[model samples]
Every structure is written in C-alpha cells, then in structure tokens.
Target: MALTTALNAASVYGAMSRLANRAQSVQTQAGGSGESGGLDFGNMLRDQVKSVVAQGNASEAKQAGLMAGKADLVDVVTAVSETEVALDTMVSVRDRVISAYEEIMRMPI
Candidate 1:
C-alpha cells in the first residue's frame, strides 16, 4: 500500500519539467538563440546516485581493510559514518520530494 502511494505520488518529474521549461524560456529570451542552457534533471539524478554508490564502495573497502588489520579504525569509522549520513540525507530529500508531490496532486487545477 505504501509502495503504491509513493509510486502514485511521483510528481517530482512534473515539477522539474515546469522548472526546465521556465529556464529554457529565459535562456531563449536572453541569449536570443534556440538552445536552452538548463541542466537535465535525469542526468543530475543519475550522477548523484553514482556518487553515493562510489562512496558506499569506498566505505566497504575501508571495512575490509580494517578486518585485515591493515587500516586504522578511525578511517573505517569515518567512512561508515559518512556513508550513513549521505544515506540519511538522501532519504530525507526523497521524503520531502514525495510529500511535495502529494501536496501538488491534492491541489485542484
């Protein structure tokens, strides 16, 4: 049920599309060219996810080194903590985005 709700509340793309359209209009007006300088949300999202995956891999390597008695405990702790923080931040952002989407959907257009 929760999964369905989350899936139904996926309005972030709509919001991003509106924003991108606005940016494109402004760029076309200011630059007097057909090209829009706005960034792609899909690419940005993918890049951020890749960065988190890289951090997670680094953290895993640190833990492995620690187990081998070749790495400092401090470094291992830092890497794990950083990964946890990043995950927490991403989760928080996701929740907020979902909430915003739900709110927008509730609005009468």
Candidate 2:
C-alpha cells in the first residue's frame, strides 16, 4: 500500500511538472519571462477546491438565512445553483483526470 501511494504521488508530481513546463514554454514563446510565477498545478487545484468549498458553505449559509427569514429566496436559489455548478465542474475535471491517468497506465512503457 505504501508503495502504491508513493508511486501515485510520484506520478501526479511528474504530470504536474510536465504541465508546468509546457505552460512555461508557451509563456516564453509569447514574449513572457520563464519565471515560475506560481504555476504550480497542485496549488492551483488546492485553491480551486478551497473556492468550491467556500461556495458550498456560502450556499448553505444562504439557505440557513432564508430559513430564518433573513435572506431572499432568489438569493438562496442563486447561491445553491452556483455551488452546484462549481461542484459539477470539479467532478467533471476529476473524472477526466482519472480517465487520462488510466489511459496513460494502459499505454506500453
């Protein structure tokens, strides 16, 4: 189990590194300096997850406020809808990433 975990971590790191390199190359080609500029994929994903969680929390808070007669129904509905969309987008990205990983694993090394 430890070996599998290590391998998974290494694979994710390698993929992120490759993506960062590609982004850096594109930026360089577009007349931008090749500085790191915080193009870390893991950090980006972490930030996005945090944003999604915040959105969900806000949506719940809005619903609670509506229940307490302190918020409008339209505001609650909008918050809930936005949260749903963000969650759905995150799930879709996860599925695609998993699918890509599986496909890569199936490839001959």
Candidate 3:
C-alpha cells in the first residue's frame, strides 16, 4: 500500500537524521570545531581544568560574600559544590594522564 511505503520512507529518514545527529555529537565531544579538524586532547583537557579552577575561585569569592551578608548562602554553597566536583574530576583526569605518560616513557623504544 502507498501508506505503508510512505511510513517506511519516513522511518528511514528519521533513522538517518538520528545517525547524523549522533555523529555531530561525537565530533563535538572529540573537540572538533565545526568544519575544523580535531583538537589536541591534552590541550583541551588543560583548558577545561583551568576554566574549572577559575570557576572554583569565583565560587569561593561568592561564598565569602555570603559570609559577609552580600550573597545568598544557598547560591554560594551550590556554586562551591559544583566547583569542587569539577576540580576533583580534573585532578583525577590529570593523575591518569600523568600515569599513562609515565608508563609510556618506561617502555623501551
């Protein structure tokens, strides 16, 4: 039937669209700039860690303001907590990368 054929075509199109979206997501996660090649993983990680540390510092300043009755305690706490989690994750990633580098260096050329 024509209805069945149309439905199949629609289903195929939908699947293709989903696949394209997934590919784009993967590319973005891999640090590819739109139309540009992939970014260096170490550089990307370093930049992210630096940004997270800056956020953490800002959160600390906000917390200090809360203590001085300038900002809300709840907002300050949430910011600080999120920053703490980011910093912890950054530190863990750095440790893993360093360990991998050391292991690689230990291998005979």
Candidate 4:
C-alpha cells in the first residue's frame, strides 16, 4: 500500500512537471511580459481539473482492463490510488479557496 502511494505521488509529480512545462511554453509563445505574462491562476486551475478528470478516466480504463485480464492488479491499484489522491487534493484546494473567499467577504471596508 505504501509503495502504491509512493508510486502515485511520483506520477502526480510527473503530471505537475508536465503542466509547468506547458505553462512555460505557452508563456513564451504569447510573449507575455514579466508582470502580465505570469501564469494565470484560472488557467492553471482549469488545467489541473482536466488532469484530475483524465486520471479518473484512466483509473476506470485500468479497471476495465483488469476485468478483461489485460491489466495487472498492481496497475489497476496504482491508477485508482493516483486518481483518489488527485481528487482529494483538488477538493482540498477548492475548499480552501472557498474559505478564503468567504473570509475576504467578511472583512471590513
């Protein structure tokens, strides 16, 4: 189980690295200035959400493969673990964002 978790974490790290690389390439192509050319939080959030959805689909695919005897138990387990972790992380981020927004709304003028 610990090994599975570690492997899943590594996969998440790889995904993050890929996203960062894409963001950098996009920034360069757009010729964004240092101030206005920084990564957009909305785009990053959308990309991460898409990544999480893709992971979920992958987990489902692995399960189907296991059922068809085309995938190993370990592979299915790892995919599911990765999906679960990604979903949990996304949910946590969403909750924190909401909390922060609420706090800001409650602040004085």
Off by more than 4 A, model 3? 1-36
Candidate rank order under TM-score? 4, 2, 1, 3
lDDT of each: 0.64, 0.70, 0.65, 0.76
Assess the local accuracy of residue 71 in candidate 4 as a C-alpha lDDT between 0 and 100.
99
lDDT of 2 by residue, 1-109 (tens): 8457435534544454455566556766777553486675655665676667677767777877988999999998898778768867877988999999999999998
Error of 3 at 79 (Å): 1.3
Candidate 1 ranges with C-alpha deviation above 4 Å: 1-36
Instruction: Please give the RMSD to the true structure for each candidate, in Å.
Output: 10.7, 11.8, 20.3, 9.0
- For residues 1-109, what per-residue lDDT tens digits would candidate 4 score against the true structure? 8568546755765665566567667867877534556877856775787788677767777877988999999999998888888878987997999999999999999
Candidate with maximal TM-score: 4
**So what's the TM-score on candidate 2?**
0.65
* Poorest 10 consecutive residues by lDDT, candidate 3: 8-17
Tens-digit lDDT track of model 1 for 1-109: 8346333323432343455466556756665544258865544654555555567668778877988999999998898778668756766876998999999999999
Scored against the true structure, residue 38 in model 2 reaches a CA lDDT of: 63
Best by lDDT: 4
The residue-by-residue lDDT of candidate 3 on 1-109, one tens digit each, is 8457435534543443454456556768977654446665644654564567467567767866977999998897798678668756766876898999999999999
Sequence-dependent TM-score of model 3: 0.58
Write down the lDDT that model 4 would get. 0.76
